[model samples]
Target: MKPAVGAIRRASIYAVVSYGGLVLINNSGLQLPSMWIAYLPMFIGVYVFTQWVDRKF
Candidate 1:
């Protein structure tokens, strides 16, 4: 697989797992409103960093 594609796939897996865990935690009592907003930058940031890493390493 291309480096970019691999990076994206791994990032996606991470996003899904993290989001699910957060939602589960929220449901259990840590109500954080509009968590998607928090995740937006993180998602982009992770992608950016992963791309940089993929290129650098």
Candidate 2:
């Protein structure tokens, strides 16, 4: 149960950081060719980072 809670918290933090970064980029006037172009890499990056953190820790 505790591990589950910790996993959820960690994932939530990653999600918030990714979302905030996207928001910042959108506000900075740089535009991607498509929304999927922007989102897909970000999603993959977050997933990779999370896996790395879990493994390293």
Candidate 3:
């Protein structure tokens, strides 16, 4: 149960951070050759963060 709660917490954090970042980028008027390129780093960062969070708690 603790692990489940921790997982949920981490997921929420990831979702909020990802959404906020996308929103900021969209509003910043920065042009990208491809959106996938932007997503690549975000996904990688979130994955690494999730892994760290899992190990942390």
Candidate 4:
């Protein structure tokens, strides 16, 4: 149960952070036809952040 909850929490964090990235990109006047491309950075960012958090917490 704890592991499931932790996974959910991590996924939620990634979703929020990725959305923020998408908004930032759009606001910056760089409109991507395939917005999924923009998610690359967010995915990497979230992966690194989660890894660090897991190690530290």
Best by lDDT: 3
Instruction: Please provide TM-scores, in order, for all candidate models, with all chains considered together.
Output: 0.48, 0.60, 0.68, 0.65
TM-score pick, better of 1 and 3 = 3
- Show model 1 residue runs off by greater than 4 Å: 30-57
lDDT of 3: 0.78
Clashes of 4: 0
Write the residue-wise lDDT of candidate 2 on 1-57 in tens digits. Answer: 989977987787688767876786677776767777767787788777777776665
Question: Of the pair 3 and 4, which is ahead by TM-score?
Answer: 3
The sequence of per-residue lDDT tens digits that candidate 4 reaches over residues 1-57 is 999988887777767776777688778776778766776777788778776675565
Q: Which candidate number would show the highest TM-score if scored against the true structure? A: 3
- Model 2 ranges with Cα > 4 A deviation: none
- Cα lDDT tens digits, model 1, 1-57, are 687877786676667665775576557653457767666766676667656655654
Between which residue pairs do clashes occur in model 4?
Answer: none
Task: For candidate 3, report its TM-score.
Answer: 0.68
Q: Which stretches of candidate 3 lie over 4 Å from their true place?
A: 50-57
lDDT of 3 by residue, 1-57 (tens): 987888798888788777877787678776888976777787788778777776776
Q: What is candidate 2's TM-score against the reference?
A: 0.60
- Estimate candidate 4's alpha-carbon lDDT, on a 0 to 1 scale: 0.75
